[model samples]
Target: MLYWLIKHVLLGPVLRIFFRPEIEGKENIPAEGGVLLASNHLAVSDSFFLPLMVPRRVTFPAKIEYFTEPGIKGRLKKAFFTGVGQIPIDRSGASAAQAALDTGVRLLREGNLMGIYPEGTRSPDGRLYRGKTGIARIALQAGVPVVPIAMFGTDKANPIGSKMWRPTKIRIKVGEPLDFSRYSGLDGDRFIERSITDEIMYALMELSGQEYVDMYAAKAKEQAQPLPDRLPESRAS
Candidate 1:
């Protein structure tokens, strides 16, 4: 109810006017079934824009903190994310990541599209990064096609911590649905996951026209920061 209300009544109509997203190959998305939307995380708006353009409702697992924080800000945060149909997942560590994938798989099993950032977190830099294999695991577990979606230019609209929205032409390109059934059944080989990750990235590379980095997106993002500890999940050592 809340999701539809926002999608139709409130926010949707407004966003449709200003942040006009030029979507390409939208037909690549399955008509009515579960699918894994593996997309590059460029900006916060990336989440809403793609889902808004799609006919089917896509669900992404947001960080749990978005819902559990206390106070007025927390309440607003919860309302905003829930209205967009984001499920909360804990990103504490590996176990939590598995749990997140588990939740995503559950959604897919129910014939719902599950959107994920294989890079695990937002890429501070615009460069493409390596994706974790959790997406592959879900693809195997749920028997759903993985659709690689790439987004560009939204980063300029909302860069890092700008309060107001900027006018930037957003481009979203969808790739053909990729089937991994043959490799999905492989016995716990790391190569299988790596291959799946490469397939998705290759599609994104073609769509976004960005140089592909064999490293993790989160790591590329971390390197841009001056923090004492800048390691990211699934970093290529």
Candidate 2:
């Protein structure tokens, strides 16, 4: 398969040789069975590097656009992502949240590991943001343990808005699996979901040592951008 070829034969060796990626607490990841890997969103490379360093294949639900773009480049891009274990999910409409849960639950129920970014988007300034509760819901619904992970130096290796990769070393720290079975049958409770999500985020904050922001990453990005200048009223006369 292309995934095996690229990881073992093509790209994996090249990356290990240059970047020297390191991982701590690798043993925390179970050798088998289903798990939900909840990590902070840093650079786009977080998706690539985290999976690259882990022994087990980690699959994330990527935006549907990654596989739907037109033209040759798009096709190749889609192929590469799919080969790398990215699944496409439609992130539109009112049911997008449920749709994502369905996709993740199916994978977990089938005894597969699933990677998720609870922030829903990349952090704008490397500060940890409030985690979305969808991940919590998925874990509860699937009865899987949530493994909190934190990736460092990935932003420097493949920074935001950069089209090329750098040689910065990447490090990953994995926390012990969090079991929320005590809150069983409470998947539909928003309060329980929020508590679970906050607990996972706290674990990530401890691992990554990043400043915690209570707002969503997308909202923080919007707040960081300057607003457009407004025209003075011309009809005052």
Candidate 3:
């Protein structure tokens, strides 16, 4: 279908030829069954490149805004995400977070590879951030293993404000799947969830060699805002 055509024929070929993305530990991904690909979010291209490299169709819960914007560009974006099987979740309201996790659990139970960023958002400074527990909740709910993946050089190719991708070498490292089968049926336990999330973040830190920031990426970005304005004072101007 459209996913196959885009990944294999249209976009895949172009990316392979130019970026020449490399992957390590490909064998770590389970050959079949419901599993979680827990990865560190480095850049927007992390989504594109990971799916292209993996054999299976990886589905991500895209923010509802991506599918609801106005104008022709918005229409195309919606169509592309829908055609490729992305699930749109409204990332607003108190119930939105649970709804997204519910969708992921259902997908995993259906034996689909669900791509999740445990950190919740892209790393603002390329350092691994403390992971949110939604990933752990989904994994425990679905009774699946969590595979840690590290993406390298994507931030350079698709930096924060770049509209176009540059030719930068890309590399992916997949770590062994972390099994929390012993914690089965304990999905809602906050302590267990935090423990599981921290373990996943540690694996990503080891794989990516990025500094592990104790704070969440979103908070770090917020704090980073004031530094820019303070830079002038530090420079004595």
In terms of lDDT, model 2 sits at: 0.91
Candidates in order: C-alpha RMSD to true structure: 6.1, 1.0, 4.2
- Among all candidates shown, the one with the greatest TM-score: 2
Weakest ten-residue segment in model 3 by summed lDDT: 228-237
Q: Can you write out model 1's per-residue Cα lDDT over 103-163, one digit (the tens) per residue? A: 9888999999889888777776787888888888888888899998998888998887888
**Against the unseen true structure, what C-alpha lDDT does each candidate score?**
0.85, 0.91, 0.91
User: Candidate 1: minimum summed lDDT over ten consecutive residues — where?
Assistant: 181-190
Q: What lDDT is obtained when candidate 3 is compared to the true structure? A: 0.91
Clashing pairs in 1: none
TM-score (C-alpha, index-matched) for candidate 2: 0.97
**Candidate structures ordered by TM-score, highest first:** 2, 3, 1
What TM-score against the true fold does each predicted structure earn?
0.91, 0.97, 0.93
TM-score-superior candidate, 1 or 3: 3
What lDDT does candidate 3 reach at residue 87? 76
Please tell me which model should have the higher TM-score, number 1 or number 2: 2
Model 3 CA lDDT for position 155: 96
